[model samples]
Target: MGSQSARNIEVLNQNIAELNGDINVSFEFFPPTSEAMENTLWQSIDHLKKLKPKFVSVTYGANSGTRDRTHGVIKDIKERTGLIAAPHLTCIDASKDELKQIALDYWNSGIKHIVALRGDIPEGGDRPHMYAADLVELLKSQASFDVSVAAYPEVHPEAKTAQADLLALKAKMDAGADRAITQFFFDIESYLRFRDRCAAIGIDQEVVPGILPVSNYKTLVKFSKLCNVKVPNWMHKMYEGTDDDPTTRNLIGASIAMDMVKVLGEEGVKDFHFYTLNRSELSYAICHTLGIRP
Candidate 1:
């Protein structure tokens, strides 16, 4: 039994090494609000660009509040950096004409890729207006851009059921979405199960797993609650009392991410999307662990 356990660990480690060598990665960033944050964001961007990511995405704020800034940042990145800039577009608090104009603007600006989403309601709102209805509707309307829609490995927060969510994803693919980026998940099993379910339903688009390097456990827990992502009890326990130990927390976070990626690689996933949260260390360390060099 001991020998078998040791062999299993060896196999897992071997898979991790191989994945680190061959995996392709992308990153997501949000438009900065303040001058200080803007500086920090640029610094993070500069650092991660050294890894030569497949592309870098800038997220739009809820209700299109930061639409202008998002576009500006994306344009600047395309002009100044070597990374492919993909700005997120959402179907919330915007009319069809507005959404179309945004898509057209991106296309005209040489931004070919878009991460389309049904953004959450803004704060203090009783209910969202569903302006664009959902992502599939937006995808169907926007014919020029290569669209990537969101997927929930554990199911979307407002979804009726997991099967319904998968069907919705299939609909989005049918509506001309090129790919799907899943919400961040802790366990590899969640993603694997979701992928299998997608396969069973004949949804063939590439579903890139979203990797979030934990910078703050408390913050992550709060965000997860808002997004309806389950944070495993074991995960909380792992970081239970490490609040004061930034170094150890970051090390555990990187290890957890590397192990998750290794498991996903075993399941035949070759691409990953890191939700950088405007920071670089944890994401950088995880990439380094995967053999991505600066």
Candidate 2:
């Protein structure tokens, strides 16, 4: 028994070492909705800061107050932690002038990177930036910001077809967007297929895979549905009996993320974007498993 355990540990160490630190990682954080959440958000930031991520982004919902919170958090991350903070800007319920001014403000505030998007319309809100391609064009006209647009491995929910979605991405790239961060996906083959399709169609840009650590099956299911992500049956089976066991749930979550990234690394993928929902333990475990150290 002791010999078998030792051999398993050695094999695990070998697999970890095979994934060198050639990877560039970034994180996405949502703006905190309340004071306590704000505290938790910053705590998670502090916990993960040592990883020296490529950049940290704050999500902006389609609302005025939430927009303000996004900007505030972006500046706070830059000032307090000295990390590269990218603010997500949406052309939702705002005029072209409003969006341009916001872009100017971000540029003036020493923000060089922006994630431009035509955000989801809020309940009863209008969508002024009808397409993310248009938002990318607008950002380029305003300033030479490093802009990233969102990509969907599974066709975007609103897309007419997969080919149409690829054309939209090409338009964004042509309009001077630098890269794309994908919506989180569980299936590795789905992303690889998307990559191949992008390459065949002449879309030249990095499509960083978005990784979501699933600490709670219920929350994961809800968000995945909102984003049009398919939850595989294997995942459902894995979380079957952990409804009340957070400790076990967290372990399973980390294990899933670890397996996903390891396979990605084998495929020569070196960039990762994590949708960290103001938590660090699962993300930390996965990153550490991939040989990413403080």
Candidate 3:
């Protein structure tokens, strides 16, 4: 048998080789809420554009009130930055005609990609009503643009079971979604298991893993709970009592993200979608760790 040291060196060399190639990456950003926020978003976009992402997505607000602003930002990004702008379209608060009109507008404006979603209901609101109950139906109704749907590796908060969630994902792909982007998860095992389950079900579209570099542990914990993503106890211990140490927290966050991506990369993931959360530094640092120099 080969020595363990030799095998380890071989694996390390393989990872280095994989990093040398062009790895497709995309970023997700929310539409700015104010003038200053708008400035920061644009600056982040400008800085990250040099990395040549496959495309960048701008998120829509829960109620669709930011529709105009989202459109404006997507249009500006396409016109000004030479980046493919994929605006998120949701079915939580829009009628069929309104959704179709928005799709038509995007098509007319030279935008071709859309991240179709069943957006979360506004806080403490009644059941959401719209043309599509979920993203699959929405994708089926709007056939003009290339559509992407959400996938949940750790299972959606509202989903009763992982099987049910996977079935929902299959329905989206069956409805002609072009790709699936997952919600952020810390565990690579969860992602790998989800991918295997998808393959078993014969849903074969690209499912890009969403990466979120933890900037604020407290905020991440809150969001993770809301979204049903399990925050491992080990993760908490890693950042335990680092609340006041911003510098140490960020360094630990970056290292954790790098380790996560490296493990996923080893599992044959070539594409990644980062939830930038409107900040560029942590994501930028993670990219650097992956040997992605812009």
Candidate 4:
């Protein structure tokens, strides 16, 4: 048994050596809604900043207050961390003129990267007048912004067909998007197939996989359903009966994430975007396993 365990360890070390610290990572954060949460967010940032991510992005919302908070967080990240901070811009509850103005403001403030998205329509609200592709064009016309748009490996919930979804992504890329950061996913095979389809359709832009380290299983499931992301039966069973033990859940989450990263890295994926959910331990551990260090 001891010899077998040593052999397994030797293989793992070989895989890490092959990865060769060539992986680049980025983190995503959401604006904190309360003082306590804000503190936690900053703590996580300080802890993970040592890893020196390529860029960090903050999610956006449709409301005015949330919009202000998003802007504040983006600027603060830039000022405090000296990291490239990207703010998410969505074409919902806003006009083209307004978005152009916002883009101009971001440019003037020295913010160069933007994550262009078509935000979720509010409950009972009117459908968006513009889409992500249009927003990408608008931003490009206003300034030379490094724009990143969203991609869905599992097919967007509203898309009528997988082909339509791929075309949507193509439109965004054609509109001068620098790259497409995918929605969080667990199914490694799904992402691999999606990449193949993109290449088949002549999409030359890079598509970075979004990795969500599950901190809370129940919360993940709820959000997954809303986003049309599937939680495989194995994952469901893995988390079953561990509701009260966060330590165990976190260990399991880290193991799954490390496994995913190992497989994806072997497939020549050099970039990973982590949806950190304002926590650092799980992501930090996973990065360490990938040979990323301070």
Count of steric clashes across candidates, in order: 1, 0, 0, 0
Q: Which tens-of-lDDT digit does each residue in 175-249 have in candidate 2?
A: 899999999999999999998998898887898999999988998899888878999999999999999999999
What order do you get sorting by lDDT, best first? 4, 2, 3, 1
> Model 1, 85-200: lDDT tens per residue?
99887777677777778777788788988888767776676664543226556645665667778889998888899888888788788778878999999978888989899989
CA RMSD (A), model 1: 2.3
Candidate lDDT (C-alpha), each:
0.84, 0.88, 0.84, 0.92
lDDT of 3 by residue, 71-149 (tens): 9999999999999999988887887778878887888888988998878777787776752225546545665667878
Give the better candidate number (2 or 3) by lDDT. 2
Measured against the true structure, the TM-scores of the candidates, in listed sequence, are: 0.92, 0.93, 0.91, 0.95
**Ten residues in a row with the worst lDDT in model 2?**
121-130
After TM-score superposition, what is the CA distance of residue 276 in candidate 2 from its true location, in Å? 0.6
Candidate 4: tens digits of C-alpha lDDT, residues 125-233: 8878999999999999999999999999999999999999999999999999999999999999999999999999989888999999996999999999989998999
Clashes of 3: 0
Taking all chains together, the TM-score of candidate 1 against the true structure is 0.92
What lDDT score goes with residue 273 in model 1? Answer: 97
- What's the distance in Å from true for residue 18, model 3? 2.7
